[model samples]
Target: MFRILFYRPEIPPNTGNTIRLAANTGSQLHLVEPLGFAFEDKHLRRAGLDYHDLAYVRVHPDLDSAWHALLPANVYAFSSHADRCYTDVAYQPGDVLFFGPESAGLPEEIQRLPEITDRLRVPMMPGSRSINLANTTAIALYEAWRQRGFAAGG
Candidate 1:
């Protein structure tokens, strides 16, 4: 399964939607702190519906801890500033699709990490700010899954 990493995400519904996505896609969701809302936030619960129990969700206290748990795998950082398009790469099952907080994209330091296999972006019209967090996650995850032949999908 693919691993979806959210770095310091600041929105509840977005994370909640990601939980639902993860459950449906057989992917793992990794959240790095400090989170804007509590795990028990009503907005989150409502957005995720009943899939919370079905999803593989792990919360790390910090980025370092997240890296400790997810290392030894290829990581692709999603950033608006990146030069490459997300679909250009052949994604593998164990690949990590890394995203940043909705308020701000991945930090420059994080994007420059040696662990990042590449930096990618979804195509957008010029002058557009950015795509919604949950939407972008879905786009990237589906593309990667499609590249892998949608194995294990029912």
Candidate 2:
């Protein structure tokens, strides 16, 4: 299964939707702290819509903790500034997909970190800022799953 990492995500609905995404795709969702909204945020609860328990969600105190828990895995950090497209990589199971806060994308330092296998972007029309965080995650997740023949999806 793949793992989704959100670094300091600031939005509630997006995270909520992602929780649901993780549940449906059989992926685990890892969240780095200082989140803008509390876990009890009503918007998040409403967006999650009774799927929270189905999702495998883990909260980390910091990036270091996340690394400690998820290292030795192929980490692909998503950034709009990246030259590589999301589809360029041949993703594998156990790979980690990293995303940044909704307001600003992944920090430059994080994007260039040696821990990350590569930085990638979801292709969009010229001049577009970026895609929705949850949507981008779904695209990458499905692409990776598709590459693996959507194993056990039946």
Candidate 3:
């Protein structure tokens, strides 16, 4: 399984959709503090449907706490500014796929952290600002899972 980290996410539905994705894919969802919405937000509940109970979600106090819990594993930071493509990596189980808030992506400082194995980007057409958080996540996760032959997906 992979671990998906959301840093200071601002949208409830986005996180909710991710919860559903995590549940279906057997991935763990880690959220950093200062979230824009509460866990009980109705929009989130609606977006996630009934998958919340099926998903493994953990909320960390901050990025340091997340690192403490998730280190000892490869960390790939997803950023639009990255030179490398997401598909370039040979993802392994337990790899951490890190993402940032919807409005603003990962902070430059965080992206440059020594802990990151690499910074990856999903290719897009010219003038495209960004992809939706949940969409980007699904793209990366599915690709990783596909590379593994969709193990355990049956």
Candidate 4:
């Protein structure tokens, strides 16, 4: 399954929802710390209900650490500024799908990092706020999973 990378995420509810998404989809949830919320699973459970139990979440010390842990995988960073639409990409198992904090998207310097092989965006109506973090992750993950025929499970 593909991996979900939350880069310095700050919102609890967003991570909460993504926890459910990851758990249900058989994707690994990689959180690059320092996170803004606790990892007690209570907050996530509060928001995600019993689905939190299904989550396969891993916390990283930092971006470099995450990269070291998951090397050679194509990383698709989600950014509104990107030119490519997400659905256009051909996702592979172990590909890293990275998203930045809700308050601030990935830093421009980070966006230019060589580790990022591609950047993509979900189509949205002009002047509309970016989609919720969890929803965006869900949309991207499902699209990638759909392309793979959802093969990790029966």
Model 2 over residues 13-102: C-alpha lDDT tens digits?
A: 999999999988889999999899999999999988999999999999999999999999999999988999989999988999999999
lDDT of 2: 0.93
TM-score of 4: 0.94
Query: What digit string (tens of lDDT, one per residue) describes model 4 on residues 1-154?
Result: 8899999998888898888888788998899999988877467667777776677888999999999987799999999888999999999889999999998888888878999999999999998768889989999999999999998830
- lDDT at 118 for candidate 1? 97
What is the lDDT, from 0 to 100, of the residue 58 in candidate 4?
A: 84
Worst 10 residues of 2 by lDDT: 145-154
- Which candidate, 1 or 2, would have the higher TM-score against the true structure? 1
Indicate the worst ten consecutive residues by lDDT in candidate 1: 145-154
Going through the candidates in the order shown, the clash numbers are 0, 0, 0, 0
True-vs-predicted CA distance for residue 147, candidate 2, Å: 0.6
Tens-place lDDT per residue, model 1, 1-154, is 8999999999999999999999999999999999999999999999999999999999999988999999989999999989999999989888899999999989999999998999999999999889999999999999999998888641
- Score every model by TM-score: 0.98, 0.97, 0.98, 0.94
Candidate 2 Cα outliers beyond 4 Å, as residue runs: none
Ranking by TM-score: 3, 1, 2, 4
Best-matching candidate per lDDT: 3
Q: After TM-score superposition, what is the CA distance of residue 138 in candidate 1 from its true location, in Å? A: 0.4
Estimate, for each residue in 1-154, the C-alpha lDDT of model 3 and write its tens digit. 8999999999999999999999999999999999999999999999999999999999999999999999989999999999999999999999999999999999999999999999999999999989999999999999999999998731
Off by over 4 Å in 1: none
